[model samples]
Target: MPRAFADITFTDSVKAAQSLYGSRDANRGFELAEDGRHEIGPREAQFISARDSFYQATVGDNGWPYVQHRGGPAGFLKVLDERTIGYADFRGNVQYLSVGNLMGDERVSLILMDYANRRRLKIWGRARIVHEADEPELVARLEDPSYRAPVERGIVITVEAWDWNCPKHITPRYTVPEVEVMLEQLHAEIADLKAQLANR
Candidate 1:
């Protein structure tokens, strides 16, 4: 199908979003000034990092934005310039939802939060997925000691606008050790259930 047709279909799908969300603020509940009053500088750009916890937003085929948690090495996120960030795409279980979204649309958003300090940074940009194996720039960024595998592709985000969120007093919910324990328990439960089914 032509790109225009896909865009038209996506547009039609989102027409009901406002009604479904029950509010006119359908886009992540963020409000942007029309007159471009807010501006981000170099000092502010340096504060956003992957280590602090980041969320990546990509548009589905239906034009709805899907957000996912992004985490890895701190250097996985490179501030190419004051208004650009780049990161490698590591191999996962092969469910490339974000990559699929990028293929159809390059626009994306990233939100990084420093929970301990109650700081949050939201970034909106265009993303380009580089799939070539021998791309020099991608290889250089993947050379960081923290990355265990060679990156198959990289998502380059060119920041268009940014917003800093205010502090909200919320208690910490989970810790690293708790996550591991929960996973172990779930694995054991699955194994037991499988064994019982085998005997049946």
Candidate 2:
């Protein structure tokens, strides 16, 4: 864990819980560590580019935390720079819970998962909502040309800190495309075996 991530996440209550659980000492090392991981690195960029979906959490005016799943084609979430990432907001159920929450509180947290690889990334950031009328070029940049969904707006996040979590207890789950690749390889092997049997 990076110091920046620790700084943002480790509250007094959290520390107290960690102390009760005997993990406080171990976690303190993270706070003292120098690596901040405030900017995206090459490995982070690659992982972020490959993710098709993420869970976004926002705080409502009533103080309730709202979590919503944001998804699109792989790479729909664009990394504008080392410190910025964004996505085009497609029309959904029209509840506008997330958008409304962002208007009230720009602070947001995101959890991106690679279930097949058993990897997860956590991001803390402030978000800005952009309308097409305001920044057409930016909205266009965030949108995926091949995706059929109609985008209503754009959400750009200024990354404050990010951290990769351990894979413990994360069940490996494969996407359809990943399974198809495995099946294709299996079929090729089966054909080769049949050819060998015929030769014999």
Candidate 3:
């Protein structure tokens, strides 16, 4: 049997929620529209698009939280509409724990943080899976360089609530020169290996 939160009375549920997550701020609830302060706006959408990766949280059959990193295009997340966002599910090795969890329960939370920019976006929603054969839009999104063949499905999230996370105190750095040198060395090694194989 599934662990049922539905069995708890409304008052008990409220108390439980507060105990678990701290006090209930009027700006933080299930419905984005209900919380005027937390609602996602145009600027929020742009910020999310700029993020490199997002963290996804799902509840497994045992009700334990399962979290993972989801990465792809610069703004792999697309705002399908005011209340919906679409994300492509990339190919991976056969452990489909997240997909299985989604099948049983759709509620999910996504967090995208740009440590360099000191910005973040938190999205709470319910997900619906769309098989590749059924969704042309998903197919197109998955066609980009970030993914390979054999996409199982795509997830469409109906946004319940979304908010901007407070900025953090971290600076960003890049190592362009080091990366270029490494690539050059790798190319030379590959050429040497090819010449040896040819002589053999």
Candidate 4:
């Protein structure tokens, strides 16, 4: 728990709700979330690097929260440094809703999930949209050429704080690769059994 998270999440309204539920002490010690804790350490960097896609949320001009899924090859999101992370913003539905929203307000929220592992990470950050013409090198840093998508811009996020969500209700899911691995093991076992029967 980073103090940045506690500062925003443990507000009077939230505290009142906690008190109503007689859970006032439920989130104790989160205030101790410090710079070292909030900083994106090696583990956090590793997790973010492995994510192929994430959900980004921004407040629209009309005050509604608009969430868009951003995706690319694995490790598309570049960990520029401890506090900064970015990704190439590929061409998408021409609405530009998220881009417009970020212009009005830089504050953004992101959710990255590893469904196979039942793990999720929540991030709060300020985002900026930079055009390729303006910062080609920065955009180049984030681009995954193999993805073969037209990158209209680069969305850079200055991480403010991050938190790992609990996995209590997450149902484990397996990807094609994971299933293949299991199938290979079963096939090998079946072959071994057949060999034993032949020997008998």
Candidate 5:
């Protein structure tokens, strides 16, 4: 756990739980995070760039938490800089719950998952919505020319800290593209086997 993440997550209540669970170490967490697991370096930037979808969480004025799934072509989330990331928020069901929640609180949490690779990344950041009128250049940078999803605004998330989760028991799930490649290899093997039998 990075200090940035651990700092916010390791509250007294959480510490009590850790004690109850028989884990009595906090230094290791901080030490490992300091060893370069917490910063948004090139590795993190590349990981975030390849993700097609991510789940964003926000707290509402009513104190309720909401998680919204944001998706686009691979690399929908744009890394503006080492510490900044933004994405074009497309129009959805029009509930506007996320926007409303962000209005009350700028704090945001994001989880980007690569199910096929059994990898997950957690990011803590403060986010603000930027309108086209307010930031046309940013909007253009994040927009996908091929994706026809009508973008309402852009959600700019400024990274405070990020952490990578352990890939324990994360069941591998294949996308259609992945399955197609597997099937192609199977067909090629069958053709090779048939040719060998004919030669015999």
Candidate 6:
């Protein structure tokens, strides 16, 4: 866990809960660590680049949190730099709850999961909505030509902090491509076994 994450997330109530649970001592290390770990490193960049979808949570002016799932082709979410990441906001349900929430409050939280590997990353950041009319070049950079989706706008996140979560309860899941590769390996093994039987 990064100190920056602890700094941003470990509020008084959270610390109180930790103390109540007798885990306060263990959690103290994150606060005392010298490295802030605010910037994304190589490992974080690779993981973020590989994610096709992420769950974004935005708080509205009414104090309610709205969580939305944003997805596209693999690597649709671009790692603009160590401290920044963005995605082309494709036209989806016209409710536009997330966009509206961001208008009131810029603070956003994201959860990116690697279900097959049972790994997840949590990120906190401030998001800015960029319109094509305002910054066409910036919005264009986030679009994936092969995805074939109508770009509505661009959501750029200036990352504040991030932390990797332990994969304890995450059930392993596979995408179609991943399942196909596993099936192919199993078929090859079966073919090799049949050939050995034939030779015998």
lDDT of 1 by residue, 1-200 (tens): 22221222225356476557665454423333342312346656567543535889899889988888866766567776665678777787788889999999998877777664566776667898875565776656634575677577877776666666557763445447557988999999999999999999
True-structure lDDT of candidate 6: 0.94
Instruction: State the displacement of the C-alpha of residue 154, model 6, in Å, after optimal TM-score superposition.
Output: 0.3
RMSD of each: 12.7, 1.2, 10.9, 1.8, 1.9, 1.4
Prediction 1 global C-alpha lDDT: 0.67
Across 107-165, the per-residue lDDT of candidate 6 in tens digits comes to: 99999999999999999999999999999999999999998889999999999999999
| Poorest lDDT segment (10 consecutive residues) of candidate 5 | 30-39
Superposition error at 114 for model 5 (Å): 0.8
Give the candidate number with the greatest lDDT: 2
Regions more than 4 Å wrong, model 1:
1-40, 50-52, 132-134, 169-200
Off by over 4 Å in 2: none
TM-score of 1: 0.63
Q: Rank order by lDDT, top first? A: 2, 6, 5, 4, 3, 1
Ranking by TM-score: 2, 6, 5, 4, 3, 1
**lDDT (Cα) of model 2:** 0.95
Cα deviation of 100, candidate 1, in Å: 0.3
Window of ten residues with lowest summed lDDT in model 3: 1-10
The all-Cα superposition gives candidate 3 an RMSD in Å to the true structure of 10.9
Give the Cα error of residue 99 in candidate 1, in Å: 0.5
* Overall lDDT per candidate, in order of appearance: 0.67, 0.95, 0.70, 0.87, 0.88, 0.94
Query: TM-score: which is higher, 1 or 5?
Result: 5
Better of 1 and 3 by TM-score: 3
State TM-scores per candidate: 0.63, 0.98, 0.66, 0.92, 0.93, 0.97
**What's model 1's lDDT at 120?**
70
